[model samples]
Target: MAKLALLVATFALAFLVVNASIYRSGHSSCERQIRQEDNLRHCQKYLEEECSDSPYNRPGRYLDSCCQQLENLERECRCEGLQHAVRQQLEEGEWEREEARELFQVAKTILRKCPNFEEPRRCEMQSRRWF
Candidate 1:
């Protein structure tokens, strides 16, 4: 009877260990996903800030960096990130309404220049549908 009780206790401990590991693995993965989405948001915000900093100037260097950051995101977010960044910039109220419009146009041009971006298509849709 003692041997049987020991075997049951051992089985319970093994079961708890397996469940604990699985829970930790799943929890970490969930955290990673959240962090990735947060990264995407922050990247877009930074891109807008960068663009706003150098408006009316050549953007060859920093634009590349911003596009690269967005490109690193999941395939779904690359272009959407640009749009979000532009809108976010406008919402920040740093630029006048007319200036915001100009920035939107500039963003469209940047979208065209960025490699792997669909260009013009989504940009036009943004103008028609969004603003």
Candidate 2:
């Protein structure tokens, strides 16, 4: 009976360790997601407030305050956030097809011009469609 109790206690300890590890990992993942979301929000606000006025129709001027904004964002995270914003605008009819495409091009340019920015390998602009 003593041996059986020892065996049961060993199994319970192992189970508790595994459960604790899983909980910690899950919590960290949640925290990382929240941080990414906050970063995305900051990028979006910067784009709207500082970049919108410049418009991409002209050269050089487009990057004015935009480069500063992109510089502050996580490279891959900002790419994902920009793609999401463009798609959301297109789907919701908040922007015309041409305007959305222009916005995307502007984002790409900002990523290219910003110092230390690395373009995401998997980031692809959505295909243009006629409305």
Candidate 3:
């Protein structure tokens, strides 16, 4: 009986350690997701407020504001997050198909304009749906 109890206790302890590690890793990942979402929101807001209609029409001025918003973000994270965010917006009916397509184009253009921005292949594939 004592040996069985000891075994049970050992299993419980191991289980707890494993659970704690999993929870900690998940929590950190959640935090990172939230941060990326916030950054994407900020970038969208900046584009809406600062960029003129047909920003590609004036690449120089567009680059100034757009690059400022995007420069601080991790390039891969920013691209992936933006693609997800835009897809969510489309799914949620916040944007019409054409609007989402245009937005994706503008985002791609902005990323290209930003110095040292490495365009992620995933973003390209995801955003290519409209094209």
Candidate 4:
């Protein structure tokens, strides 16, 4: 379920770059959540393509990008952000739940690859694995 959460979170917060990550919307929390979810559905495919490193070290440095994208989040909020991105991507792609779990595991395995990555333990995605 890690990949699912990764994909979903990555796409869900496509707004990560669009200013929503730090957005102070006048809308209610519920409305904002819905909007984030919708954005995930609409943009997960592109985000995955741009944010993934699998299928041969993606060109855009998706992990670095993800790190940067999530950097501004509070410590506890980091995993939540990841989960949202993964979930969006997974949901949009119709991938299996197991993929999400594996992706999370894969992510943990490769954590050292991102020297500067600072995702806290909550982002461990221990409940999932990655390719």
Q: What is candidate 3's lDDT per residue for 1-131, written digit by digit as tens?
A: 99999999999999999999998886566447646446455445434433335444433543454455455555545565556545544554455566767666655555665676666533452766654
lDDT-sorted candidate list, best first: 1, 3, 2, 4
lDDT of 3: 0.57
Leading candidate by lDDT: 1
* Residue-by-residue lDDT tens digits, candidate 1, 1-131: 99999999999999999999998886565445434655445544444554565665443546666666655655444545556666666666577556666666666555556687663334532744344
Expressed as tens digits, the lDDT of each residue in 4-123 for candidate 2 is 999999999999999999988865654455355553444344334333444543445434344454455455445655565455445545555556566566555446555666565334
Which stretches of candidate 2 lie above 4 Å from their native place?
1-35, 45-76, 91-93, 118-123, 128-131
Please tell me which predicted candidate would have the highest TM-score against the true structure: 1
Weakest ten-residue segment in model 1 by summed lDDT: 119-128
Candidate 4 per-residue lDDT over residues 3-82, each given as its tens digit: 99999999868867667644544234434453444533322333455445468644434555455444444445445455
Angstrom error of the Cα, residue 124, model 2: value is: 2.6
| Selected candidate, larger lDDT, 2 vs 4 | 2
List candidate 4 segments past 4 Å from native: 1-60, 107-114, 117-131
lDDT of 2 at 16: 100
Task: Give per-model TM-scores.
Answer: 0.47, 0.41, 0.45, 0.44
Model with the higher lDDT, candidate 2 or 3: 3
| TM accuracy, model 2 | 0.41
Tell me the spans in candidate 3 whose CA falls farther than 4 Å from its real position.
Answer: 1-37, 46-69, 88-94, 118-122, 125-131
Kindly indicate the candidate among 3 and 4 with the higher TM-score: 3
Instruction: Give the C-alpha lDDT of model 4.
Output: 0.50
| Per-structure clash totals for the candidates | 0, 0, 0, 34
